[model samples]
Target: MPKKWFQNWFNSPYYHILYQQRNNAEAEFFIDNLCEYLKPSAEANLLDIACGRGRHSIYLNKKGYDITGIDLSIASIQYAKQFENSHLHFYVHDMRYLFYVNYFDIALNLFTSFGYFDTDYEHVKALKNFQKALKPDGLLVLDYFNSNKVLNMLCPQMIKTVSGVDFNIHKKIENDKIIKTIEFEDQNKPYIFKEEVKAFSMGDFKLFFEQSGFEISHCFGNYNLEEFDPANSDRLIFICKKAL
Candidate 1:
């Protein structure tokens, strides 16, 4: 397993943009869809794991749910804390050992952030941690890339600008894994970073959630909460429930 190289996000314009756009057009879609699906209590406590910058936390808090977000990145936590309403709080912590058993009524892991672990074993460990943190019969939602479609819709290179910096991203696929190389340029200086992981299929994730003690409640193809077909989906959203 390759080590995760996530440190570049702070100075990397690419990551900064992603962090700033944390509450972009997709925010309402994810918030409304998940809320509608879960029907969370006005008083329910929701956990946003890997919640970089707390966009989801802010939105859910506005809707009257008590939200607590956790992220491994301190910078991201700082960004998230900016939107803290009375009902929202954020911490820098690992989601793999949440330490809050039977606690959250709803938990969300969105935007393909769930697979940064070094190994499949560790991946499942985090899943079980999510299971542990959820109240019995609580809902857990995951928004991820549709692996099937990702394989076909793969892009080799793309350029985008964010936070007044230009980013050049390159992707390489090798043996069920994706290698993402990012080059950030601001004022003619270039800084580069890399991160990669083995991408698993939806069936694999379903088995993972099952082994982690969750039952699939729903799966969607897009941000609009539409049904997913393996061949055509741009996104894969899974709404699961803790097995009673």
Candidate 2:
């Protein structure tokens, strides 16, 4: 769905038809690496901002960390609550303005979790919120889609089927932004969805993070922990530390 679809579209015909079950593979991939790098004590406090489905929090809790996940999607939070553990909890909360400040040993923003806001200011607010929520010398890990790579890889059209429903998808990019339309059909009855995503270069994020009081410590193109190659990498994993 388009930018507006994120407004309340999960209940719309679009999400119901296409939002398939996602495994913990993506979350586990990051958490395993994060644990090895940070070497957080068993008592370290973690906050998973925008934790849809609580995948990361669940995995971390199993690894003996104190975890809390917050997301605005009730549907996603509900699914997350099912796997709650003694040291893990999930709540429905917005990330644009977090409710806590200077409380977490670590904060995670993973799974291409950046850039859904209508404006760059909102996204900046998100980064500032992360800074405010982090303790002194706290670590924050950000995993986001590489804007350049995605835009360059943009395909004009795609055809596929899920649960017997056929889908025809098209994409258009102009002026550093992407616009997409999806048409879902079953028995020839068509259902349409549109999505708009802002494309920001890697430098944009680097400058933004610097202004938000964060210093880049580690940056990777993908979960494999390989060196960052902006043009070819799909995911950008950033490990930034609070400057203060």
Candidate 3:
């Protein structure tokens, strides 16, 4: 059997090189705003799902929270392990499987991380796993691109040169999925990878949450915590709580 696109591409060293320019400042700003709004207890336990490089976990740990970062990429987890301490830890784990049961005060699936699975059933299963990880009434913060806005403003093709590698990218929506094809040549070798994410809308997520035993507490349009506007928001951020 072939490996999933994410399992292959995300573990590749080239993936880090291509995305090396991801803005730390922006991430920090968003985290700060989220903390201000959520105001979790100082000793709260945080679970960062698909925590690439453990950036968010490390910052949250610094803020006096007990943080656990988990990702499927072994390389990413290895790099993140260097920052581990009594309050912070990293593990290579799949979101489709259960981790801790009723252990965390908050669970976060950030940065458009929820839509990669091939089936709605799988996505819902992942959400249930997240739900299981949290204590009763525990919070879950899920951040994803606003599919409506993104499909409306889809760019068909582009070339991005990062670290001297020219990545030729093509994107399209097919079969209710957003597909991105990336191609690049490095060290005289050609490589290609595809990323497919379900173009889930507010309605779709509502159903997922309902099935996963969660109730939506708040919906934000952006990292600033503005009210969600389906047609205008750049992001779809959902704050949910375990349902009684």
Candidate 4:
């Protein structure tokens, strides 16, 4: 069987290099707003599922929470582990499997991390894993793209030069998935990568959360926690709770 696009693209060094300039301020602001809105206890135990490089986990730890960050990429975990302390931990683990049962006050699947699977069952399985990892009534914050808005404003192609590397990117929606193809060169070698994410709508997420034994507590449009408008918002942020 061929390797999954995510496994190949995400584990590549060029992936990090291409996205190295992602907006950190916006991410930090979102984290701050989320924490303020949720108001977990000062010492609450948190889990960051699919936590690439542990940036959000480290920030949460700095805010006095005990955080465990897990990702499928071994390289990412190894790099993230360098920031580990008594209150923060990093592990290489797949999201479809439960890491701990009834163990966390909060579980976060941020930055559109939940929809890479090829099948609906796989997506549901990952959600169940997240639900099982949380205590009864524990919170889950799932940050994903607003598929409707994204499709309306999709940019088909672009070229970016970052740190002396030129990246050519193409995007399209096909078979209900948003596909991004990236091509670049490094050290005189040509490389290509593809990312495919399901264009899941709000109704789809509602059904998934219900089937996974979670109750949607809140939904937001953007980092500032604005009301969600399917046609206008840039984000689909759901705050759910494990069913009691």
Q: Pick the candidate with the highest lDDT.
A: 3
For TM-score, candidate 2 versus 4, the one ahead is 4
Per-candidate clashes come to: 1, 3, 0, 0
Q: Summarize candidate 4's per-residue lDDT along 191-222 as a digit string, tens digits.
A: 99999999999999999999999999899999
Candidates arranged by TM-score, highest first:
3, 4, 1, 2
Q: How close is candidate 2 to the true structure, as a TM-score?
A: 0.89
Please list the residue runs of candidate 4 whose C-alpha ends up more than 4 Å from where it truly belongs after superposition.
Answer: none
Candidate 1, after superposition: displacement of residue 158 in Å? 2.8
RMSD of every candidate to native, in Å, equals: 2.3, 2.7, 0.8, 1.0
lDDT of every predicted structure (CA atoms) = 0.81, 0.80, 0.93, 0.92
| Superposition error at 155 for model 4 (Å) | 1.4
lDDT of 1 by residue, 106-214 (tens): 8899888777666778888899999999999788898888888877878999987776676788998876788888887667877888767567788789889888989
Q: What is the lDDT of residue 89 in candidate 3?
A: 93
What are the clashing pairs of model 3? none
Return the candidate ranking by lDDT, descending.
3, 4, 1, 2
Worst 10 residues of 4 by lDDT: 19-28
- Point out the higher-scoring one by lDDT: 2 or 4: 4
List the candidates' TM-scores in order: 0.91, 0.89, 0.98, 0.97
- Winner on TM-score between 3 and 4 is 3
